[model samples]
Target chain A: MTSYSLILRTAARFLLPLLLMFSIFLLLRGHDLPGGGFIAGLVASCAFVVYLFAFDVAPVRRMLRLDPRSMVGVGLLLAALSGVPAVFFGEAFFTGLWLELELPRIGEIKLSTPLVFDIGVYLVVLGSVMAIVMALAEGEE
Target chain B: MSLMWSTEGAGLLEWVIIAAFALMCLSLGLATLRLLLGPTLADRVVALELMASITVGIIAVYTISSGVSDFLDVAVVLALTAFLAAVGFARYLEKRGHGDD
Candidate 1:
């Protein structure tokens, strides 16, 4: 077994949630800002990587609950599906469709197909990177 | 060089930013030298980390100079990557039995 450091483990535990939150924030603000799915996914995967370094591959895999390959598949499907609604509307493929909703608490909210696509990209990146990282880490043992 | 000394529109903040940029560039050059010349793997890793941090700082300074807050996200991601890289290197060193602790 690889030797672990208590300081590293403790830091990882504290950093995991913060990193995940920041990644989500990046995803949410990505539409108009510099943040985006690719960077967000990278950050999220880095969080998992930190955990992997502190512990082992088994626990990291277990914590993920779903296989990374499946995540990639799901992301691709979502990205493809996001463009389908445009076809139904008699528009060109991958045309951006937007919806505005009014809510009492949060006021008006704007949603778009591009946002969905971004989420898909986020998932694909996160999954692929994790898959590679986990495979390499497991191989080391 | 002209922008650094020109007094037409340059303010105190701009001067400070220019100074920061110069210092960051100097540090970056020094870190690169260490990364290339360090005798040990640990020293090289530390130099790499320093370079990464300087990169983040450069991004932040650019964002401020450009008046675009979006680049801060880049800084954030760069910082995260640097931290992960450091952790990964430490783990690698530990596995190779070079860990000091």
Candidate 2:
């Protein structure tokens, strides 16, 4: 591997967390807001890409454990689950519902089917981005 | 393509979307070039990743432009399916037990 150690280490330590948070923010605010799950996931995955490029894909994969494919499956399941409620409510498929829950500590954290959908979106994005990357990375190896 | 995009006229939002789309196209193109010309396999993978990011961005932009949330589903599937495949391949490489061979 090439030596650019400092750049790689710094990116993993400092840059990745911020990137992940930004991704979440984008996913959460996506409905009626400026961002969504797909964009957010890519942004988050970019951080991982930095890690993969800097160190190597093997260490990172081991560190994360559970192949990215599993996450992809989970994401798909979650997204589909999010839509099921619509059918139960006598609405057409994917009829999104927005609700709110008032919590004592965190105040009112709005919850909705859309948010659930976003979570699924986040997972899928995270999974797929990693999927393509790992495949290409290994192909090269 | 311009005609389709310009149906809404040159509003600020329209310009922004257009610019963003153009930028994504450029990035994807750059990544494709790298994938084609890379001296190493890893470099090609990285380039492929860069391309994927742009593609996802384009999806999001289109979803927003259309205001039809239905498009979001497509974006979700694309992101998950493609990324997972990448992960599977990575493990196959790691399991080879060939670390330094």
Candidate 3:
């Protein structure tokens, strides 16, 4: 078990949510900007790693609420499924599709198949990295 | 790159940015030296953190010099990683019974 440090614990408590939010921001702005799913996933994993450093594996596992390996499987499924919708439209696999919607309060929203693919990538990266890190940390104990 | 060297249209702000870049490079070199020569693990980790921070500074400076905001995201990611690296090192040191140091 890792020894507790008051300062590190406090900082990790605040940083985890902020880092997660930034990762989402990176994921969302990735299409037209210099952000993307891969980097965002890394950032998110870093957030959890920070939490793990301050606390322990058990709490971190509880917070996650699912096995990291399962996350990788679900992410892979989502990535494959994201391309299936294009096949329904008579397009080849992995073809980009877009839908634009206007909601009353939210104004305009542009949805795309690429976004789904990015989310899948994010999940895969986050899951695999966390699983590896968690295993290593637990082994250290 | 050419903009930094060209004296034709350089302003005070550009000169300051160039100076900032020079200072950052100098500090980066010093940090690298410390990382190579530090006697203790903690010193090496601190040096590494310093190098990470200087890299972030370089990115920020480059962003200002080039008038592109996109690179700021890279800086943000770098900073986050650096923070994690520092925390991880601290945890390792504590585990090894060197936390007081």
Candidate 4:
């Protein structure tokens, strides 16, 4: 992996940001559009995978401060907690709740508990994938 | 008869998706063959990766054909994890002979 050509490294330098943005776009649009948190998280983690391919795992670990295993737990907690609010409101668990807000630059934005759930799924997927990739990469070393 | 074709007639997008699906299936078949016949572990790993990628393509084609956008999530997840499988195999190969002691 470290012996990759200079061309690939240069290409990745530009491609990484574009891939991240596309993943975020997928995450945001997932509620109403073709994109969603699961796919977006996969895309985001793959972007890191691409980075790891071009470089290595140490920098990626540094960039992501927390352990990937912890990320998985945090994601699960966030997803479960997203449903708890609805339960407290006398709604069934995991019921979708919505909030409408008007922001200056973004204009009208709609938020929902499902979106939070999706975000949690995204994080879990990303973290788990990275954990596997990192563990394998470490073993190789 | 454009009207008649509506029932049996394929739209451009439909045709494209169908063509892509066929190509993916073809590749998947070839990958499967290689996976079965490969003499080396590395060749088998490559074939496995190819099959996984073709599966992703099949999922994408199904998404378009069925007009179900959510399957894209499945495709993305598959694509992401497929690489991990590859990495894991590679590591296993690295450790196979050297660490036996």
User: Pick by TM-score: which candidate is best?
Assistant: 3
The C-alpha stretches of model 4 lying farther than 4 A from their native spots are: A1-4, A33-35, B1-4, B7-27, B45-101
Cα lDDT tens digits for candidate 2, B1-101:
34455665647778899899998888888889998898766667667767766777888999878876656655664665455445544444455534421
Q: Candidate 2 at B98: error in angstroms?
A: 28
Tens digit per residue, CA lDDT, model 3, A36-64: 88999999999999999888888999998
* C-alpha RMSD over true interface residues, each candidate: 1.1, 5.7, 1.1, 3.4
**Which of 2 and 3 is ahead in TM-score?**
3
What is the Å distance of residue B36 in model 3 from its true position? 1.6
How high is the CA lDDT of each candidate model? 0.90, 0.74, 0.90, 0.81
Candidate 1 residues lying further than 4 Å off, grouped into runs, are B1-10, B99-101
> Native contacts retained per candidate?
1.00, 0.00, 1.00, 0.27
Give the TM-score of each candidate.
0.91, 0.57, 0.92, 0.70
Candidate 4 lDDT tens digits, B1-101: 24423674457766787789888888888999999998888888899999999898899888767766778877866876786577556646765744311
Cα displacement (angstroms), candidate 1, residue A106, comes to 2.0
Candidate 1 per-residue lDDT over residues A1-141, each given as its tens digit: 876889989999999999999999989888877778898999999999999998889899999998999999999999989999999999999999999999999999999999999999999999999999999998888
List model 2 lDDT by residue over A33-112, tens digit each. Answer: 66787777777787677677657778779865868999889989998999899898899999988677888898987778
Question: Which pairs, if any, clash in model 1?
Answer: none
The segments of candidate 3 whose C-alpha lies over 4 angstroms from its true place after superposition are B1-10, B98-101
Docking class of 1: medium
CAPRI verdict (incorrect, acceptable, medium, high) for model 4: acceptable
Q: Chain B vs. true chain B: TM-score for each candidate?
A: 0.85, 0.77, 0.85, 0.81
Model 2 residue B100 lDDT score: 27
Lowest lDDT block of 10, candidate 3 chain A: A1-10
